[model samples]
Target: MKRTLFAAIAMAAIAATSNAVLADTPSHRDAVAFVDQAKIGQNLPVIALSIAKQTVTFTTIASKLGNAGAVKAVSDEINALLPLYQPKWNENIAQAYEKSFTEEELSSLASEGRSSKYASKVLAQQGVIGKQMESTSKPILTDLVTQALRTVMSKTP
Candidate 1:
């Protein structure tokens, strides 16, 4: 019975150590650095604005109000809120980078400073990265647009 208990304890320790090593395999900081170096988050505002414009809630509100100024105000408000959400978006991008590349690859890409080769490597993996980001961001963006629309609608005359 003592031998069995000892074996169980040893196995538990090994499992915990293995998980710790796996968790750090592709460090989050390395992934974030790679994303920054690649300017991956630079277009987040543009993407957010585009999504806002395309959302049915936004369009319906604008059309019902028939006020250019109101539409612009809502757009401006959304843009203002973008900064608050940008960090979350960037963190998601960093996670995508971590999942798609190894620690060595991310470090190399970041150190290369967005060279053509680095761009090609990233471009090659765009589908995977894009899918990951879209799946994670869709709900968040939808909620943002929905809330903005509700706020505007509440204030409309």
Candidate 2:
């Protein structure tokens, strides 16, 4: 349960900050089109599955906190709340896309993504990039946290 909560929290934080990261740059129309044309929306199922897996993991952790009844209670609570959060999470995803890209970019990206070659190229690149990111995220996050702590400590004096 703890992992589920942490994953959800992490995803939410990423969704929240993603826009800010892009705010300084113009949206890539080709990218937006690619997202649409490639049927990337299929990832929603992956996201849902990830959440479900986290919930089960969380339930196990919660079970360890007390008796079996307490475990059931915690697990039930997570299951109940997750459904409620799903709609909002989905909306936030849509809004993030809408806010991040302009209509023109989206249209252009759509056309670009229409080509099988272009779509394939994009997907291949995405796979490589995703792997790199997965490998590096922990180190990057750790560095940032360490930097932040140093900044705070430096200011304390």
Best of the candidates, TM-score:
1
Q: What are the Cα lDDT values of the candidates?
A: 0.60, 0.38
Against the hidden true structure, what lDDT does model 2 obtain? 0.38
74-102 per-residue lDDT for model 1 (tens digits): 77666767777666666676777666677
Per-model TM-score versus the true fold: 0.70, 0.34
Where's the lowest-lDDT run of ten residues in candidate 1?
Answer: 11-20
Candidate 1 lDDT score relative to the true structure: 0.60
Off by over 4 Å in 2: 1-27, 57-109, 114-116, 132-157
Range of the 10 consecutive residues with the lowest summed lDDT in candidate 2: 132-141
| Model 2, position 92: C-alpha lDDT score | 32
Give the clash count for each candidate. Answer: 0, 6
